[model samples]
Target: MRIDAAIDAFVRQLTVDRGLSEQTARAYRGDLVDLAAFAEEAGVTEAEAIDLELLRDWQWHVSDRLAKSSLARRTAAVRGFTAWLARTGAAAGDAGARLRAPKSDKHLPRVLDRSQLDVLFARLEGRAAGDDPVAIRDLAIVELLYASAIRVSELVGLELGDVDRTRLMVRVLGKGGKERVVPFGVPAARALDRYLGAGRPALLRDGIDALLLDTLFLGARGAPLTARTVYQLVASLLADLPGSGPAGPHTFRHTAATHLLDGGADLRAVQELLGHASLATTQIYTHVSAERLKAAYATAHPRA
Candidate 1:
């Protein structure tokens, strides 16, 4: 079979048999597309034509241009594709199984401090008012992010029915398409209410059911907000705020988890609220809380 044909079959297997998400399948398709392009450039069109040397050349070529994370994701895609091809008798053996990705630096996720969060929200609050629908939506987006600490994808996935205003809870469909209800404070609830009642309605056209709709903010064309757009908004907003750290939705997630711990929220409870897969993932916030406590003690205590 041709390389392209094998990739098509592999993607089908991912979608039908493996039950991978569309996002995952799309990523696999992208990786294989890049690989196929490289193969075509090298004048090898068939699956059987690829060998270990060609694979090494592709890896070496990408190593210089791509980040370790990208390389790793692509490697996983190819490995899965090759394994499926081998199992289906399209290839003699899985040639990509032994492929290894480069070592990446373990950078801890960024978390905003309490004071910094206050500053960010205050800035957003200042810009919250206006006849412009996008501003109102942008403010609510930032507020909900800090207030809820949800993934960017989850934020964009929110629907009108998912929010329970009376209970101050937002229902989210998280990883693996699992639904979980998370509650936010009155401040977040109020921001959300304003966005829904005032902001979204202004931007909605004929057929929008999204909570934030064409907005809790809108693009220039008044379309639904995207995850990349959200990231850019957060980064640009944070560019003016004082202090240094990674700034994005995940920053708020880490901040919210740490703040929850600082406020004496039980670790397990925070885990549940954040929809963490394991307690271990949630335990990282405990260290941030402990560090804060140590700093407070060191600054205030006079005893030698």
Candidate 2:
């Protein structure tokens, strides 16, 4: 069998039997695709034919140029692939058993300050109130993203029936098909109300009740907004703002979570709101909150 086809089957097994997240499965497939391409060029076809020296050399070639995190993730893919080969009796032993990922740099997430958020929100409101339905839809998209701290996929996948405005909560289908209810503040609710009432109707070319119809923010053709479009919106907003960091839809989530913690929201509460399966995932915002507090104290307090 071709290595690409074999790697595809292996990744499918990881998804169905091992219950890995789709993102993880996709990453594994990407790493293995690169490996398969290289092996095919070198005339190595079978998993058993992959020796430690070849594995080491491939990793060395990749590590020399790729970022440490990228190299680390690719290394993990190698280890996982080799382990799978051994488990399935395709190989005598794990060829990459001793392979190591490079240490990754722990860069803090970029966050917009409260004032910046205020400015962005103001701009969003103005845009939404304009004579365009797309702008109105974009208002709701921005509001929900910042308000919920959900992944972009989750946000775009949202349907009208999924939101329970009566309870001020949204039912989200998170990673692993896990369902969770995430709450947002009143402001988000208002923006959503505006979109549903006024904006969405203007964009309806078909009978769809999706809360964010066609896409929350539609293009000139009146189709739903793509994740890339949402990312560009966030990036554009960050560019207008003063501080510099990795700006994307995710940055809004990090900022929202950190700000909630800074305002003394309980850690567990933040965890649930973010739909994190582990408290550890939510705890990163706690560190962000603490860092902000330290910075504030250093600037404001003179008691040193």
Candidate 3:
């Protein structure tokens, strides 16, 4: 089979059979496409022509240009693709079974301190105190993001029925199509109430279709809210802060998780709240909490 056709089949299987998200499938497609181009350059365009040496050469070709993390992801992508090709009999063998890449560099996720969060919310609250619908919606978005620790994708994908205002819970469809209920605080509930009662209605245009009406959050023109919009909103808020890491919506998630741990929330409970499939994935927040404690002890200790 041709490499390109084989890659398409692999990506289709990733999304359809493995239930991977579109974003994940896209990443796999991108990596495999690059590999296909590389293989073509080597006069090895056929899927069966690919071997462990070709895979290693391709990794070496891109090693200098990509960071270890991106290289790791690309390596994993190709490994999966080759494994799929072998499993489905599209290739003679798995070319990437022996492929390896350097481990990704681990950095503690950026987390906002309590004072920083207070400053952020104060500004948001000031903006929301007015009658501006966009400002109101923005407040609600930030509040819910920090309160629920949900992914921005899950947040924008939320629908009207997904939220339970009476119980302060939200149902989110997480990665791999897993559904989980997360609880928010009273502040988030109040902000959501204000948005639902006034902001959303004001933003909704007349003659809108019923599908958009079911969306939990809407754009300025009554369309469903997008992940990019949420990213910009959170980025702008985090830009003025003293931190020096990523300023996207995931920062809110990290901050929320770290704060939960700092306040004595159980590790397993937080894992469930964050919709993490594995406790190991959620343990990073414990590291963040410990780092914070170490910073405090180092700064305030009398004998240091």
Candidate 4:
């Protein structure tokens, strides 16, 4: 099979069989497409014609251009693609088996302090109280994100029926298409109710069609909300905050988990709520908690 054809097959398997998120599959496809383009430039387009040298050369070609994290991801993508090609008999061997990726920098995710969150939510609720449709939706969006600690993907993927208001819980379709019921607080439930009853209807009045049908969150035009829109919303929300890290939806995820830990929620329970496949990933929040405690102690101790 041609390298491009093999790439498509691998991505299809990733999407259909592996059940990876479309965003993740798209990233892998993009990385593999870069590799295939490099292979064609090297006069070897067939999967069977791939070699370790071609893989190494491609990595080196982009090493100077992309960030270490991006380069590492590209390397992993090629490694997985070549291994799949070998397993499927499209390639004689795993050409990228020995490919090494640059080490990605590890940074603890930024979390919001309790005061910051209190002020933020207070402002949002005040605005939402005024009957602003977008403000209501924005408050609901942040409320659900922080309350459930679900990914923004899961947030935007929600349907009107997914929310179980009586239970104060929501059914989130997480990564790998896994479904889990995550509980939210009364505050979030109230914000959500206000949005659904008043905000959503107002947006629908502007326009409504099948494309806008059933989606829980609506864009400015009543279409299903996009991830990019959520990103921009969160970015603007955190624009003036003090701290460093991604000003994106995941910050709310981190903050929620950390706050839960601070409030004495069980570790495993948080793991289930976040839909993390590994406890090790959940343990990172413990580290964040410990760090916060140390900072508090250092500031308060008289001897220090």
Best by TM-score: 3
Residue-pair clashes, model 4 = 0
Q: List, residue by residue over 1-304, the lDDT tens digit for candidate 4.
A: 9888888899999999999998999999999889888889899989999999888899999999999999998998899998999999998888888989979987789999988898888878888888789999999999999999999999999999999999999999998999999999998999999999999988774446776578999987788899999999889888887889889999999999999999999999999999999999999999999999999999999986
Worst 10 residues of 3 by lDDT: 84-93
Q: What are the lDDT scores of the predictions, listed in order?
A: 0.80, 0.81, 0.93, 0.92
Task: Summarize candidate 2's per-residue lDDT along 106-140 as a digit string, tens digits.
Answer: 77778889899899989888877776877877878
Local error of candidate 1 at 293, Å?
5.8
Per-residue lDDT over 1-304 for candidate 3, one digit per residue giving the tens place of the 0 to 100 score: 8999988888898899889889888888998899999999999989988999999999999999999999999999999888888888888888899999999999999999989999999999999999999999999999999999999999999999999999999999999999999999999999999999999999999999987789999998888998899989988999899988789999999999999999999999999999898999999999999999999999999976
Cα distance off (Å), candidate 2, residue 275 = 2.5
Rank order by TM-score, top first? 3, 4, 2, 1
lDDT of 2 at 118: 90
Query: Which pairs clash (backbone N, Cα, C closer than 3 Å) in model 1?
Result: 137-216
TM-score of 2: 0.90
Descending-lDDT candidate ranking:
3, 4, 2, 1
Reference-based lDDT, residue 269, model 1: 90
Q: Compose the digit string of candidate 1's lDDT tens values, residues 99-143.
A: 788876655567677677778778778777766667778877877
Per-residue error for 239 in candidate 3, Å, reads 0.7
Off by over 4 Å in 2: 18-24, 206-220
